[model samples]
Target: MSNIIARFHKIQVQDGVKVWYREAGAAGNPTILLLHGFPTSSNMFRNLIPLLAEHFHIIAPDLPGFGFTETPENYTFSFDSLCESIGYLLDTLRIEKFAIYIFDYGSPVGFRLALKFPSRITGIVTQNGNAYEEGLDDRFWGPLKKYWKSYQSDPVFVQSLIPYLQDPANVIRQYHDGVADIESVDPAAYTLDIALIQRSGQADIQLRLFFDYQNNIKLYPAFQRFLRDSKIPVLVAWGANDTIFSVAGAEAYRKDVDDLKVVYYDTGHFALETHVVAIAEEIISMLAENQGY
Candidate 1:
């Protein structure tokens, strides 16, 4: 794992915000950008990137306020800001087009990019990237809804959830509940992620951003419109055990895209960790089928 982290190149995106990302395979090869969700960083793809690198050029970046990226105090942690920042990162890398691996928060960010530049998106592979109404309702929804409604008035109460973000036991439970096969996960990976979460004020930013999530949820229809109008191919690689988003979210993609494929894995929210090999192969096959590898 240390060896994998060593290969990553830390690049600075817009506003001198240092974005930590890893690139592998040849530059001319088809690009696959892997975007991670809440509280996790590019570290989510540490085990998966190396495997996919063999087939395609892979780029995984720690989104602004997460992982090694420096989140300035003045920076607005809204979804629009995040989406714009990612567009800047792609421009900096000179990647004209790429497919995306979207998970959790990655769905909103990645979809925003696709909507902004429809011609730039070649394909999409999603793992629990919720887009359905049912996916929005969960055990966590009750608290998140309350917080979203009164975040400005009760900022400290919002901050109190930070402890759960730091708790290894709680984090592990999140993984276990989302993933189908828990044995495949490395305990050390969770430890490192927890350390990253605690190293900076990432937890605080995440809480603040939680209140702003409604801004992104409102854009879901626009994303669906993009999918319906565009001809880009899409694949849904879902973790059947995901308790947070549920399987209904996977089915929603079928409604918009003409060419939609579904691959259900026996894991939870972090399914890529357990099904990296198969997922990597699926990504390669999807690209080859679409781009003529």
Candidate 2:
């Protein structure tokens, strides 16, 4: 497929957030809203967007506190707020109906949007985006779980975790871990992420979002209900070796979504780093099969 050039734009949302997004392809085609995960922004779609753009209009937005997107200091950095900003962006773009590609942090934001605007979401593409309890890997989440348990009573503990969470090494590990060939992973992706996270006040914003993640776990049931009830076509193109969200999470969708298609890649958390072409092909096939969605 011919590469389509992505254009960058920024729009101030209703909540005073300036959302930075990349757009490509013809507006008349089917739309794909790409919501990226933690530590990474719309830049994650840099490779995949062009491939998908051949068939669909692509909108990849950097969530607040992440990329070039500017968020007011007063703006609450929770998943709900993120969804609100994204929803407002969609409204501003006049996107009434579109498919959502959810990853990591994007899962909660996308799921919340699905819950609020059930009729608007045409389908879902989850890439390491967990909505199942079984998907949480205790090995990685153990400390976070402990922090969540003591969130109300222990300010000291939460403050102490700042170092580990904000460590550049950990950010690098997110892309390197679980992949067999480290050379295949691009340093630019994680390097850009590290630079962004090192910015003033960005760590605090990320920590705040981490604290708010407990609520996302609590809402899993509701997300599942929407999946079960809506019967929306879902494509689970996940990284099977991802230690953050296990393969079981990908399988769990079968229980809720009737029109589910699961494709597992051999890479790690950031599957697109190594498998963008295959993932894009899978997305095209899924869209072709569920054109009515």
Candidate 3:
């Protein structure tokens, strides 16, 4: 792993919420914005960023209330707020155009960004970021749905789930269940991820966001429409074994975007962890095929 600190930078967004992000690679190269899922920060891409940095400028931001970013008590962590925060980041960076890698919670935030500024999005790479109905089925959702219904009263029960997010044993299970080949994954990476999650207080935000997910689902059709109308190139690199966001969700990308190319890996939600080199090569190829190397 790279020894660099993966430095953090912050920008003030709506109502004084400070958003933090990490940047890597040459600024002159084509930009690739990596948006991470819940309970994880830009740290999720720590291993893959260096590889992609050789070919593209990479930016990964920790969404408000997650990771190192501080969120105010009055701030609403809605998809809209996230999108706006990202937009502010891009604007601050002066990145007029870029490609995006959307995963997990990253999907909703990136989708909203695309909707707001379609011209800024040149291409998209989706991994386990489901816009389809099939992606919602999983053990996680059962409790999530119940919690969503009664979050105001049963906050403690919801909060209790935070430990699971940082459990080493559970992280191992998540990797094994998600990856096509568990042996290929790096144990330290999982440990580091768990460490970061534990240190960041991200799990609490994740639980809060779980209840707020319906708001994003309602905007899915709008994202579908944006993709359909804009004709932006899309690459779907999915973990076929992902129990949370199933293979069916990968298939749904074809339904929404006209220029979608897909590659199904035998992994789960964190497919990039096990298939980093393959995913990087595929993304490079996709960008080259569309925008030239």
- Using lDDT as the yardstick, the better of models 2 and 3 is 2
Ranking by TM-score: 2, 1, 3
- The prediction achieving the highest TM-score against the true structure is 2
Q: Which 10-residue window in model 2 sums to the lowest lDDT?
A: 284-293
After best superposition, candidate 1 residue 256: deviation in angstroms? 0.9
Give TM per candidate. 0.92, 0.97, 0.88
Put down candidate 3 lDDT per residue, 1-293, tens digits, no spaces.
33334556887765677778888877898999999886567877877887787778889988886677777877666777888888988887899999999998999999888888888899999988878766787576676677777788886777776776667787667667866567787777677667666765456656667778888878888888988998888999998888778888888888878888899987877887788888888888888656685
Model 1, backbone clash pairs (residues 3+ apart or across chains), number: 6
Worst 10 residues of 3 by lDDT: 1-10
lDDT tens readout by residue for model 2, 209-256: 988999999999999999999977899999999989999989999999
Model 2's alpha-carbon lDDT is 0.91
lDDT, candidate 2, at 98: 91
Worst 10 residues of 1 by lDDT: 1-10
Cα displacement (angstroms), candidate 3, residue 185, comes to 2.1
Clashes of each: 6, 0, 1
Across 50-109, the per-residue lDDT of candidate 1 in tens digits comes to 777756778888898887776567888888888888888899999998999999989999
What's model 1's overall lDDT? 0.80
